[model samples]
Target: MALKTSCPCCGKPFSAPEDYAGKKVNCPKCDHRFVLKTREQALQEAADLEAEKLRQLEDRRRIELIEREERKHRDRRASMPYYEKFQTGTRPVRNYDPRSGPGFLNLRYLADLLLIGAYAVLMLALAGLGLTVYLKFAGVISSIVILSIVLIGWILVGGVLFLLLKYLAELALLMASLGDQQNDVVRLLLDLRDNTDVDSPEQG
Candidate 1:
């Protein structure tokens, strides 16, 4: 049919006649640059765009149909008793408890490894200090004093690091435990409400 084009910058519409094909021109309204297309090429492009829109509409319709089916299935399952819900095996029970947090991947493991590494490093430091002091002083009374000082420093630093790490690890575990307990209480409350609602209908 006829050629139709819009300004690339201002999006103003314009018609391209047969003489304007393959010509470069500025839009009259916005003075923006755009190339005019041949009538046949413009028609083909329009067809392609219309085909793309139809395909998208079909895809959306298919998705909506699938979602509607799923909703219907969920309603059917809601009508079924709890024990019979999984009897068909079509829908498996997926009880993923988030409060348990990532299974084996957690901070406690890293904390334990850090504690072990810190212990080994401190022990090595103590050994190195004793060796250096013994070599430099060579069994003098000053050597005993230096070794005592080194031992005391080692004890103080090591104790602080160890206790800090111990507290941190225990605190992490305690926090996780408290979170799980809170979730358990919420879940129990929900179950209690559900049971009361379900039983009230029967009792009435």
Candidate 2:
């Protein structure tokens, strides 16, 4: 599209391009020269162009700030070992050195190792008991009845011991996890806060 204009002196009509708004032009009929746009229009367009430049600069700064913040959050999450557990579907094993940690924690770790060793010995004894039952009842009772007695005894004893061990460990870990969740919520709130004050470009 072009700017519609007419020669003021001869009243002859002609059209100039939008880009030629502020430029001087000659009339085709009488060779009269004039500017396509008025002085007020040219100054207003210049002011508008300056305002557009400021707006674009403000927009680019806002985008860069947002991108930088996103990168920081992403890097922080990636560096956390606890966050990786879900993706890996397993926790990384760390050696529990008694000398490296608190005294009570070290004692608890040692106790856990001793309990595991005792459980292993108990399982072996249970196996021996099953063997003894088979030997004692091999000829005296039916095979199904002997097997039933052995299974019921093992189930009752093993289930109680397993429940005691598992419940304590799970409860302790659950309390620790709850504490971690509380800290995470506070950290997240701090991260999500908008501390940077950015004023938008003023158009005049």
Candidate 3:
């Protein structure tokens, strides 16, 4: 009597000898080569093999994902700024508040104003006191002395006051720039903290 078998390649029913174990057969539908087995046994073996292959593929995919995440973490850590490592203290180095108060009333500004007033007074005094001495000399000499004294006094007072004002102006500008930089740093740090908190589960 002919025993029932299935072609592994085609899933087609066929009649074959029961003793034909591990015997190669041809699929009539697709002309593929496969071993002959009972229909139920062939189907069960095919399903089991497919399941094993699927499990291996899933495991490989999971491993790849984990490796990718680790690489990203390593790259992010490596790309951090150089200063972040040496910064041991948690407190910020500088703080800025633009709207807190007026900057014009500071000690440096007051000093500059005082220096300007003093320079003006000295210029007036030099012009008044030296006029009589300058008038006593002869034509060219008196003229030269008067001109020289006036020029010298002007230079002394104007130059000194100009330098002082320039220095104070520079100082004020530097303070403003530093304040802006400090404010920017503080904002960036706050943003970084907010992002970190959102991504991490643990809170401080």
Error of 1 at 131 (Å): 58
What is the alpha-carbon lDDT of model 3 when measured against the actual structure?
A: 0.62
On TM-score, the stronger of 1 and 3 is 1
Best by TM-score: 1
Q: Count the backbone clashes (under 3 Å) in each candidate.
A: 0, 0, 0
**Highest lDDT: which candidate?**
1
TM-scores for all candidates?
Answer: 0.41, 0.34, 0.31
Model 3, backbone clash pairs (residues 3+ apart or across chains), number: 0
In model 3, the runs with Cα more than 4 Å from the true position are 1-143, 198-204
After superposing all C-alphas onto the true structure, candidate 1 shows an RMSD in angstroms of 12.6
Model 2 lDDT on a 0 to 1 scale: 0.64
Estimate the overall C-alpha local distance difference test score of candidate 1. 0.67
Q: What is the C-alpha RMSD of each candidate to the true structure, in Å?
A: 12.6, 18.4, 19.3
Q: Rank the candidate models, highest lDDT first.
A: 1, 2, 3
Which tens-of-lDDT digit does each residue in 53-116 have in candidate 1?
9999999999999999999999998877432453422222233222345333365576567667
Q: Model 3 residue 141 lDDT? A: 45
